[model samples]
Target: MKRPTLSKKIDQLIYRNHKSATTNVIGCLVLHAIRSEIFERFQRAYVGMANKESSELGNLPTSPMAERARTCETTGERLRNRELAYGFDLDYKNDPPTLVPCTWSKNYAIGLYGRIGLQCYNLQNGTNLKFKRLEKHSTKRTGRYSSVYITLDATDPATGSVCSFQTQFSNAGSHLRLRARITWLTFAARIKQIPNEPIDDDWDEDTPGINEFYKVPLPKWFSDERGSKKYYVPESELHDNDWLQLLMEVAFFSKANRRLDAYLPLELNSVVVETLEDEPRDKLKADNAIFYISYKCCADPCSTPLAGDHRAVVRKTMDGKPGHMCLEVAFTKEQNKNEEE
Candidate 1:
């Protein structure tokens, strides 16, 4: 009897192992079927060519046959890489955690004091605009952090826009400092409107709109440690402006075995603000510029004392006041204690 098709064989194997099979077992069967199908196709082609060779001269393996085998091997390697990149490990039957992008606005800023909130204004804006969160294991080390990606989307007041980005967080010592790297794809074009002189090498002819990246070092006081550090590292310069979109990669570092309890700011005061003079008398009227914001919260190390999904939100305000924006975090209450301290 002809050998069963790879699909049929896989079905039989699955049925047989259904009762006691683990995820790894299923993955093995699936991979086996894939390899078998490829090998079978190669064999069929080889037989056809061998038959032709016999008709013309004599049955023999040609150089082309070896090349075909090499190609099949290369294809298998690529499949394996793809499987690993996608976190498709069957050995650990646990369902892979779903990765979802998180966006948070000023409204979600919780438990932050006035001084701390002001420092995160622009960073929060960048976060709320367009951000993504993924549980990324450190390729260099065993520790894991919630990798958050962000992109710049300069939407017109009437027309809305969306983009994808990332932010990463880790623990340093007693302080939690965040490093934000922005990737601008289409939003680079909007940078021209700003009066500030663009860096000489900001954009190139072949460069896509604002493919620039920036690293913003968050204040150290935001961590459990009170304002210990005087100043943070300077923000990194953006090198490209050809891309229309922007990306922000933020890394939040805290003490070992500790989660970040700080909140991001929403007001422009944190970075820049415009002052207005009252009409009747020489009075100053200050208002917090409002902007749309959204975000989500997640932890890393996969299995830790306080690891799970956290609260995120999007909000807007017209008040241009300078103050703290609090967020209601949904993680361990101990984190809140850190904030209060």
Candidate 2:
């Protein structure tokens, strides 16, 4: 008779470890967490070695991965991202937290965290940064709390570039949850501050000055002619377009951590308003006019949403960075939220 397979053995362990409560879910989450955690550590060593290697590298090692790891290898840092990703285990287990693509990226935990950290950087330094993306990340876990480090790409928005930044906070509970008690979060910032411009401190980010706000002229990414200057876009730029699509991507992510009652995509209500429909024309008259589309959303995928979710996106083109957006569904009389308390 053949012995039990590794899958079966782990299944047995789960039933015993978790007392058979949501064993399947727990097992899957454990798999993703371990996979991401292990892969992260492995990639770091590989890349460090790869960069130092003289000969050009080819396909990476894939023969026989080991069951027992080395002491020297595991000794340094352990993001324990699996723990960081624990919250997302339920809904968005498909997309775990890790490094991701640049400015304007969203949908996954990596992108979401990058933007959130960037916003913190902006608030502290009076400088407005337009460029962003995750270049590198490392984390240290102790008990239920973990310290995260990011080599962020905070470029200039006008030339379309990168900037590096980080920030820290002290709280007790989990970092993902705002209720953390007393923890130390250290964020490193190496961003070249945007010059000659003041931040949009009012409800409307109206800043007028000499700006490098040129149309994105990248060869394949070049956009065509004009629409109304007041944040207006025609049908071409509205539906099925990259400009509008990126805006909507965050609509779902913005609320990812919030609690909700409506079923996703089905009960998820969305209706596009004509761009600049009610925006003041005076603001668009500036020669330094930059364009972007903004929308609303909540965040969720593999885990339960947090207490906060509803959010309005800010469209900042001149600087290569994103700013704060106050969120609330539009209505005359106050309406009861479809989300649960």
Per-model TM-score versus the true fold: 0.23, 0.27
Q: Residue by residue across 1-341, what tens digits does model 2's lDDT show?
A: 99996557766765665665665676667865775686688778765554444223335442222212233335432433332222111122235444422333332445434454454454445445653555544444534545343445665556665544542211123222221111222232334232212223222234342232322221111134434333345555455442234334434433342223332431112222322223234342222333333342333544443322232322222222233222111211111133211
Worst 10 residues of 1 by lDDT: 241-250
Q: Pick the candidate with the highest TM-score.
A: 2
The global Cα lDDT (0 to 1) of model 2 is: 0.36
Off by over 4 Å in 1: 1-64, 72-158, 175-341
Q: Give the Cα error of residue 188 in candidate 2, in Å.
A: 4.1
Deviation from truth (RMSD, Å), model 2? 22.2
Off by over 4 Å in 2: 1-107, 158-161, 166-341
For candidate 1, give the lDDT of residue 226. 32
1-341 per-residue lDDT for model 1 (tens digits): 89998678776766666645665676666767776897899888886675555455544544565556556767986665443322111112235433222234332112111112222333334322222222222111112322111112222223455432211112112222222111111111111121222212111323332111111222211333432211221123122211001111011111112234443211111111112222213111121121111212234535343333322111111112222121111212344466558
